[model samples]
Target chain A: MGSITLRAVSKTFGSTTVLRDINLVIQEGEFVVVVGPSGCGKSTLLRIVAGLERATSGHTLLDDRPIDNMPPYHRNIGMVFQNYALYPHMTVYDNLAFGMSAHKVPKKEIQTRIGQVAELLELQTLLRAKPSTLSGGQRQRVAVGRALVRQPHAFLMDEPLSNLDALLRERMRVELRRLHERLRIPTLYVTHDQTEAMTLADKLAVMRAGEVLQVGTPKTVYQQPATVFVAKFLGSPPMNLVRVESRTRGAMNPVGGAEEAVAMPAWIQEGWEDATDENGTIWCGFRPESVMKRRGPGGLEIPITVEAVETLGPRCHVHGSWGGQPITLTAEDGAMWTRGAVMRVAVPWDQVHWFHGRTERRIEPRPARLETLETGGAG
Target chain B: MSNRLSRLVPATAETPVRSAKPSHPEKHWRLPTDWREMLIGYGLILPSFWVFLVFYYGPAFFLFYIAFFHWNIFASQSQFVGLHNFAILFHQPVFWLSLFNTAYYVVLVVPVTTLLALALALLLRESAGLRGGGVTRALVFLPHVTPVVATSIIWVWIFNPNFGLANALLRVLHLPALNWLASTHWALPSVMIYTVWHSVGLYTVLFLAGLATIPRHVLEAAQMDGARGWLAFRRILWPLMGPITFFVVILVSINTMQTFSQIYTLTGGPHGGAGGPAFATTTDSLLIYQTAFLYLHFSLASAMSVVLFGLILALTLVQKLIADRFVFYR
Candidate 1:
């Protein structure tokens, strides 16, 4: 099985810990995206799984066998780096043939593998060209082909498309997804782009501060992030966090005490603890999309003064000040890429996420969401 | 406007009284022609030219001028013998032998030293980013900065007849210790060892700097594409370091051609022997000095100096022309 599992993995560089206690299980043929902001250890985690880095503690398992001490070559894992890492000295064919050659595959089999990979990546015509001569997209494809030629246990990509131009990155994302669909191989992809994490991942892990904050399907992580950090990290105009004290019957409750009754998230009703959280005091998070442009049932409409409008093609972003703080919400299917406009935005209460901000734990849930966080709060 | 100008300019009004400066183009800026700028330019250049005229061209041109006649450092009894001095110098077997020996010295030293230097440079350059690269680099470059005479003395000890460092090490290894400085068979090789040691440092530093110029991603990418140690080195590092290596080769070759301080200090004293035991260490410059200073064959030595200069020039130019085809710069 190509299923990969990381158990309590931690990595440190000198005194600074880069990744900490990462525990994850990727099922066979699962497509996973380890998404985080830059320097959040998403790439480091991917590198560790690829055996490019040695985990300082704990272990990684492929089919339940620990691989803490494995070298990259012995791990039978193919990695595509952000820069593509295509050998400038070698032709595309040679680049693709290299890994297989190192594995001591027969020359004929190597040729067959290269041919198949090239055909798959549509790089057959450029085999004789050196990496320096190829365009960015072509070079990236060759790098992928180099990995693909091995047909190893899994593929590890470290922000592999971040170097490409915007249009090309979008195009390659679809191509990569299509390839994954066809190959159906377990792949661990790292990217800081939430859009990429949402579009390409069969399962997504949102990481921050060298820790996995939440792991789930795209819909789950987007709607019900486990922590304030995840909530702030994963969205485009990231989820707005409003510090609201508990209120009972529209009156402020005693300081640091639970309110009698109020409309709250489903997970908050479950218990005092989940593995990631035991604290009762929580930070509420709601995405811009969840809080929509129109009024809907059980949705809270927050009043604000629009600061600016960012029109990104089919949709518009209404950035404004809510309760004397900046809050940006997506205007649903509106035509306003214009600047300086005011509007009231509504947040569907069922779609809001609540979490222990201190422990970075999911204390609230979204039962109405399409999917839920990895603890299986909702499906 | 007219009232104020009328009083002072009344005298000059007949000659068209305005500012007596030419002004035509609005777009043009004024260029400074002050003597200070000229003085500053002259000041900037004076030191180099002064040294060049006095030390470099002065000796080179004066050597030729003095070669036509004969001039001794101490004697007023100078004589002009036309080309007869060169004729005599050419006829003398010892002078010719010294020249031939010097040529042999260059032939033996240049290719061998260049290959060894380039090989060492490549190794040092490749491992420059690895652990202990700094220590290794410092050790390699130590000989270049150390005084040549000091190193020559150290090598002299190494090349001693029986109890020297080289023979002692050989004895420790249970290998036969051949007489180094004394044996005509080993004398040239002994000097070459010192020369290689002295020159490898400069080449290594040049190559390490050259290695820095090579983009690291290119090498890393090469590694990713499965180009391992040797292939990465031969194809990528070799091609990239060519210009620096060639420049160093030319420089070290010129330095080797005129290698004098060590030879003079180690082998040119009283009973210091003339170019080792049997003229094996008699390089071109040492031979030139023996003729000019010791024997006062100034004209002949000057002629020999011209030949050596020509040899150095020719070799350097040849290396440059050949290296041009292979040097990669980007």
Candidate 2:
């Protein structure tokens, strides 16, 4: 029922900066997840919001009220730590009631709230069980229930599912999504797992090297990554990035010469001259799933020399080199691919994302082209 | 062979894998190797066993044996006494005084030392990773490591009625200084103070170790839940520290009950020599020592030693019983 905003937030420990100039907002009833690899300061950003850590240079606001200097307990924020951090000596019921008791909630209300949470989390039978006796998934529910019973302004979860086994994590992920749908509490979740972020977040922020690179819907961040890092970070078998050696107006030469030069769509070519002005370095990226085995009109064809194939039940990843630059493309698992075999895959021009080499920032297709691109462009 | 195969497979398996034996080479080698391993373990323990038997159990059993006999160090033949030592001990007002004094010392030292150690531990835990923390910890523990006898002698001089640190501090605070070790009322209390100061360090460090085993996130979680300071400590920290507190209490109790050298060194000065002007500071352990070495009443001393042993064992077992109901392992 409250919004959390971080304005120009930065954190430094001695000389090394762990977070820098970060700006993010979690709207009322929205689920915002900050996702990145470990040591990227994603957790630090979440800690700043929870008031566990103070921002060095910026303010955190809960409902636009400055909360940077507020003690964590005074902030009335409920955070589920990565390890659950359940009071080992307390039973599930006591753990759920602890915060309410701390806040001096009435005894009757505490009982009612705990009963509701326990039932909601399917933890009725586990009310008397201590955390040590609970399984990982059960403990996670108790942790979530502890936060839920507080009825805080917002919720913060730090990789809460990371400790659970894969099957349990998936189940809990779905459960968490369903719970969010039902309650609509503003939540700021931080995780290193991309799949979890993509599935759970209403809005996603991708961070790298102490800075947020992109903040948008998961689909938009995946489709229109702001930087080369984002393009490479968000997907499984990530986007294949090939360096552009040179380009002349409408035609661009990719570094690998095994294939002929690819024809640049007019929209892409419009920004090439202005975007690649620095050191004239450019990167051509296309998602692995974007590569079709059959050619489409205006699609660039590249022959991939297959070196290894990984069969993943329904689909397979074909890892290979194109002109000495490594590329991975997915194919139906039934397809046979031997080592050193050459296969041709076509990537439609619209699927190609261009990036400037020096800045590594994505070169957006012009506004005029964006509409046509969204509607499935004609060659 | 079937039993072995069944042990390897699930109980409800439709078909047991008959190929289990060849897959596990350890099954064939386990018996002889286990024998050899046990032999190595016993070999490693043999030297300590020899020392304990010669220096500990042998004397203990000899003490029990001679408790029934009035043995003299100078005489070859000694008279047998059946329950005579116990009869005399129960009637002796000095023996009752020593027991009462020992009880008083344990009561004073155990709880006070525990609370002080816990407070110091909490302070140290807060200051951990701060500058001078290591130096503070080492300074606190320094007294425990110093020879008890040496420190006790220094303490004797410090308790001097006219010109000592104890009286000097009293005077600085504008309070009158009284006879410390020399006074019957003040003698035991002074020794208790010294005992706590000397031993609180070790218990504090024990507490620090217990606190270290707790996860940092648990406390942070408590903070987020609006539990801070005293509430967090009472609900989270104290509950978690149950086992160690139990251990420290038992250790301090046993140690306080058996206290000897400090009393011998501190109180053994001009006025009455050792057990005070009128046996004011005489504890059970000191009484046993005096009876055996000073008065040469070995049988009577052995009887007292048995009582002390019985007291310590009974106290430890009672503590264990109480702790089992309260302590949480995780």
Best candidate (score: TM-score):
2
- Candidate 2 wrong stretches, greater than 4 Å: A247-250, A256-259, A266-280, A308-313, A333-341, A368-379, B1-31, B269-272
lDDT of 2 by residue, A22-76 (tens): 9899999999999999999998888888888888998899999999889999988
CAPRI-style docking class of model 2 based on DockQ: medium
Q: Write the per-residue lDDT of candidate 2 for residues B1-330, one digit (tens) a residue.
A: 344334345673423543544576666565464575567667869999999999999999999877888888899997888888888889999999999999999999999999999999999999987999999999998899988889998998899998899999999999989799989999999999999989999999999999998898999999999999899999999999998999999999999999998898898843337988589899999999899988899999999998899999999999999999988888
Q: Score the docking of each candidate (DockQ).
A: 0.21, 0.69
Alpha-carbon deviation at B326 in model 1, angstroms: 3.8
Task: Compose the digit string of candidate 1's lDDT tens values, residues B252-281.
Answer: 778878888877766655555758677777
Candidate 1 lDDT, A33-81, residue by residue in tens: 9998888988779878876578999889988888887655467777788
Candidate 1, chain B, TM-score (2 decimals): 0.82
Which stretches of candidate 1 lie above 4 Å from their native place?
A: A1-3, A25-28, A62-67, A74-76, A97-130, A150-152, A247-281, A311-313, A332-345, A365-379, B1-43, B61-137, B212-232, B235-244, B270-272
